[model samples]
Target: MILCVLVFVLSSTTLSQQHLSHPINFCSMASTCIHDGRGVCASSPDGCSRRSFLDQCDMYEYNCDYGTQFMTKVSNPCTDGQPDFLC
Candidate 1:
């Protein structure tokens, strides 16, 4: 009886440790956004006059990573006009 109790305790502890070590990554499990094949054109009067992105997601990620907030979406793609920068 004592041996069985010790084994059970050890097994439970190991399982708890394993669970803690391998945490579920909710970010990876989250649904990913689908690309619509439409490019993003953003402009800012103060900063970059005009900029182009492959897609809206790329534009959003760039803003988030760069900590910029002035970029506004344009009605047309950058190819419509001469842009200052392209990505």
Candidate 2:
């Protein structure tokens, strides 16, 4: 019984470590793209102004061409419940 407990603890620790090793990228899960085709839903804070954002895409994303930029810009097709400059 003691050995079983030890094994379980070690296995659980290893599994958790693996999970922490691979942090989830909220960008990859963006329901909609933003800022034209030049931006991604990656984690970015400097480009966003919303003070209550909770997720990466909820506030900002990195613009490959423009460094950090708001998730959305004028003319983007994003709508409500999606990541945008007003998010």
Q: What local lDDT does model 2 show for residue 37?
A: 41
Span of ten consecutive residues with least summed lDDT in model 2:
35-44
> After superposing candidate 2, which stretches have Cα over 4 Å from the reference?
1-6, 13-15, 18-25, 29-50, 54-57, 60-87
lDDT of 2 by residue, 15-63 (tens): 7653312343435534453433432233234433422333434443333
Off by over 4 Å in 1: 1-33, 45-48, 79-87
What TM-score would every model get versus the actual structure? 0.42, 0.22
Backbone clash count, each prediction separately: 0, 0
Give the per-residue lDDT digits (tens) of candidate 1, residues 1-87: 999999999889877653323343323322254556577778764544667777666655665566554344664466555445553
